[model samples]
Target: WTILRTRLGWSRQRPARRAVERDEDAIVAWRENEWPRIKK
Candidate 1:
């Protein structure tokens, strides 16, 4: 952690995540079927 914060100049941040169950197929469906609509 010190190396990351000092040498690399990285700081802690809120991690992004999605549902553990929605990883592969369900996620693909959301991107194809729902995400585009939401983007518009």
Candidate 2:
């Protein structure tokens, strides 16, 4: 859910994201945004 929300928010901010949310981008954002929670 965290990853999904991050992707959604990131997507909204990017013009190209309207085309697609690439797997790599989502994974990167997921690591950057949600990794802290996972580590805890």
Candidate 3:
């Protein structure tokens, strides 16, 4: 793995996988509305 990454410059990081039952709408709302409030 180290040799492949060093020689080939291949990334070992995997893509994030969301749950099948994840709420897209709620996540969007939280990011848009709630995140700004908490960020301050």
Candidate 4:
């Protein structure tokens, strides 16, 4: 892992895991609309 990180610039961090019960449409809507409003 250390060799890969140094030689290949690879990361050791784990990828994010989505919840099994997550709602795709809700997530999309939040990203499209609600997130922009919240960011302001």
Candidate 5:
């Protein structure tokens, strides 16, 4: 269990949640930009 914990600690340094949030923001921004254009 100690070895597993140590390995997990080292492997979990990246910001996964931030990456997902960024992707969601980008998709929202894209949809917002497209909505007005589609009406014309």
Candidate 6:
């Protein structure tokens, strides 16, 4: 376990909630531009 953790850089934390290929810029644009319009 120690060898795997150290040598292979493994972690015990939970996986990320977001997608690996998620578009951050698009999400930001939607939040800043579209979401406000929709919320109103």
Residue-level lDDT tens digits of model 4 in 1-40: 8999999999878749978999999989889998898898
TM-score per model over all chains: 0.45, 0.40, 0.53, 0.48, 0.32, 0.51
Model 5 TM-score on a 0 to 1 scale: 0.32
Error of 5 at 34 (Å): 1.8
After superposition of all CA atoms, the RMSD between model 2 and the true structure is 11.0
Clashes of each: 0, 0, 0, 0, 0, 0
Compared with the true structure, the alpha-carbon lDDT of candidate 5 equals 0.70
Which candidate order results from sorting by TM-score in descending order? 3, 6, 4, 1, 2, 5
Name the regions of candidate 3 deviating beyond 4 angstroms.
1-16
Error of 1 at 20 (Å): 5.2
Q: Write the per-residue lDDT of candidate 2 for residues 1-40, one digit (tens) a residue.
A: 6687787664334564445646887889999999988999
Q: CA lDDT, every prediction?
A: 0.87, 0.74, 0.93, 0.89, 0.70, 0.91
Write candidate 5's Cα lDDT for 1-40 as tens digits: 6687697664435654555435776788878998789888
The residue pairs that clash in candidate 3, if any, are none
Q: Please name the candidate that would achieve the greatest lDDT relative to the true structure.
A: 3
Model 4, backbone clash pairs (residues 3+ apart or across chains), number = 0
lDDT of 2 at 13: 47
Candidate 2 Cα misplacement greater than 4 A, ranges: 1-22
lDDT of 3 by residue, 1-40 (tens): 9999999999888659968999999999999999999999
lDDT of 2 at 1: 65
> On residues 1-40, what C-alpha lDDT tens digit does candidate 6 reach at each position?
9899999999778865978899999999999999999999
Badly placed stretches (over 4 Å) of model 1 are 1-22
Clashing pairs in 1: none
Instruction: Please say which candidate is ahead in TM-score: 2 or 4.
Output: 4
